[model samples]
Target: MKNPKLITKPFAQNGQKNAIPENYSSSMESNQATWDQGFGPITMIPVAAGGLPPKGQDFNGIFNQISESVVYLSMGGRFKFSADYAAAINGYPKGAILQSDDEKKEYQSIIDNNKVNFNTATQAQINAAWKLFSTDDMLQQLAGKQPAGNYLKLGDYGIGGEFPPEVIDANNVKLGGIYAPAGAAGINFYDPYAPMFVMNRNGMYIRQFQITATGKIAARDIKGEWKVYSDDEELKTRFLGINSTAVSAKQLSTKSTIAGQEFYGKGETITITPQGIGAQPVGNYLKLGDYGIGSAFPPIVADADTLGVCGFFAAAGAGSKNYFDSYTPVLVMNRDNNYRCSLQINVNGRVATRHRSGAWITYPTLDEFNAKKSLGEGQRWQDVKGSRSSGVSYTNTTGRTIALSVSTAGAIASSSIQIFVDNVLCSRNEVGGGEGTNFTRHCIGYAVIPTGSTYKVEASSIGLWAELR
Candidate 1:
């Protein structure tokens, strides 16, 4: 812009060249007059209240939010994923939008072809996918597995995959991180099938005790197996030998057990071995009852169908309440089918076998009582040989005809069992699915018995017999 011509003083025409007179221009002296142009005072221009295109109102940015392949929206609220992402995630082809009825049919076909059975997903799988997503490819342990949706890589965040520990740390997960095998990796005794937890306690990472496949207690860089040896005569720990769990210096392969005459057709002896390493062998196989093989050694004993030493007195049952027929007894009944025996409550309040030949023999001494207690309750005891008195019974001593009021404990489903005492059927169909524990209390009424006769169980199961009050 060109400046307007400056106002001049008329005295300058005399050529006197006098100093410029003071107060020559009052308009220039004012501060506003210095910027005053020849044009009238500048007035403010009025503008309509138009603001910049709002950042939230960027139409181009909104359009770019979704991929280009996304078809137009219909009146319905459902938004279609772009064909590109859909194909990558769901194996759909390009332009497979449900615009027309034909397109809808194609969409249904895609859904039918790609649907998955959510019921098949396990809890571990479901938990892995809750908040899962792409960027976590490294953490998707199940990514390369056989995909149910026919995709090479299932979206990690989509389902059944975990975020890496790094991702978890970066995300500040509350009290969470990868639970990796911490002890020593390969040397840490890791069991993939088992639950493992690790913690850095005092700068030392620690975890559960890991047992080796060969049944050895091992640690990283630690030579040889360090077993838990007992110093006092108290603790008794059993160790699995190089080949067998129990080590027996002596083994007897006799056919028939002395007292019960349990059939050992396989010619394998029914040895009653000691449990734990020492704990004093509760020898006196006869003490186990009128049905066990005599063995010189403790621990490590097996017969044809018999495996453990505890099975000497009874037969082991299956998951279905020790399924067994009345015809077979697991143990034996002496040659004459009678044995000298008596029941007495021991210090532990247990009805233990006391006098069974020679001096009063006591089996499963105090320390080994744990293994013996399995017989006290809901254990499924069966009779393989199927003897007459297969359960625990007491002899009738007196000549007087006595009513043998025996109470039976241990719960039973009562579904297919015929419980009988002597030659008489005591009760039939008195058991059910919910009636199997001692807590359920299924008692048998008092029945008359011959005097001086031995009382014994007639069923193959863990049961209690007591003089009814």
Candidate 2:
């Protein structure tokens, strides 16, 4: 009889009426074909209608195949299928593991008595019957094995989609970016913004925080003992200004006392140095108030170098005449600071003195003064000749005051002498000669002729005419 569940074909007995030698002989062969075709890797041999029981070789063949699969499982190797497969009688139990056709990944049976060929099944069917156990790619990655290009694929770590290639080694991990690695121990993290951070065995470096980058560092306070080395030209020049030839100014602390005087504000600063005789901000300029040299008191009018005054002091030295001279006004003032007088010398060598209450008075040189005095004495007496009928006119060309005089001789009682200055009659004298005997008459006009004025003297008799300037 056939087995109820796992059926086996008929096998020959010792004595059977229908058991011929050839049929008995071929029964085992027929059953072997059926068993081999049904179970152990398919043989494709068909079973006859009344075939003998399954052969012993077929049973052994199936047992050997199961043993080989068990050996693969015990050795940490997955049972790999060459093609889609399913069992006719027995099914893979739950937890049965096998490899895919390509052997890139392994799968396990998820349901009891699963008969689905997971490699060839639809995704839904495979999900119901099998589960992915592990992947060869992930195993290679975890073992520190890189791909053909020595670059690690992110997809191997379950990351999907395309990305820039990267490398991960035993010493360092380098994510792809614009900046290249500088050393074997260097590591980098990168993104689209090109922000990269580097770390090695020596120290950590953040690209954004470097001083060369254009950004500000924000903090409440910063304290450090590190020294910075820079090669910037501007910074070097500015720092060189603090050398030996320069003044090192010290900033004053707020509300601090300096030179026995309390000062305010932190912005206040001071620079101190040796008090040389001609140093600046101290001894370079003269101080105000009373000052004297050689003696405490000197005459108001004295020769040079004998007295000193409280005023601007310039050292004596031989220089050009124009060098020591000021083209502008030089004023002398009283204690009220009002200009009492001034002394100035003109370019023509004329010295002028001025008083606060008066205008400027100029004094010529000695030669010019002598020449003018001689000219004035010569102009004191000037002679004039004229006819008795007409008047003699004299224009006062000399820049001095003058008077006119007229004398007549041989004049009758009707003869007269008259003086007119600037067309105005000033004096008239009637000359009287006794009958025919002539007598002289003098007409002295007391009229003053100003500079640039004309004076005329007329007489009826011929006589002398003169002007007193």
| Highest TM-score scorer | 2
Off by over 4 Å in 2: 1-379, 386-389, 432-447
- Going through the candidates in the order shown, the clash numbers are 38, 3
Error of 2 at 16 (Å): 99
lDDT of 2 by residue, 278-298 (tens): 323535543333232233342
Task: Give the lDDT of residue 201 in candidate 1.
Answer: 42
Q: What RMSD, rounded to one decimal, does every model reach?
A: 38.5, 62.7
Alpha-carbon TM-score of each model against the true structure:
0.14, 0.24
Global CA lDDT computed for model 1: 0.32
The lDDT of model 2 is 0.47
**TM-score of structure candidate 2:** 0.24
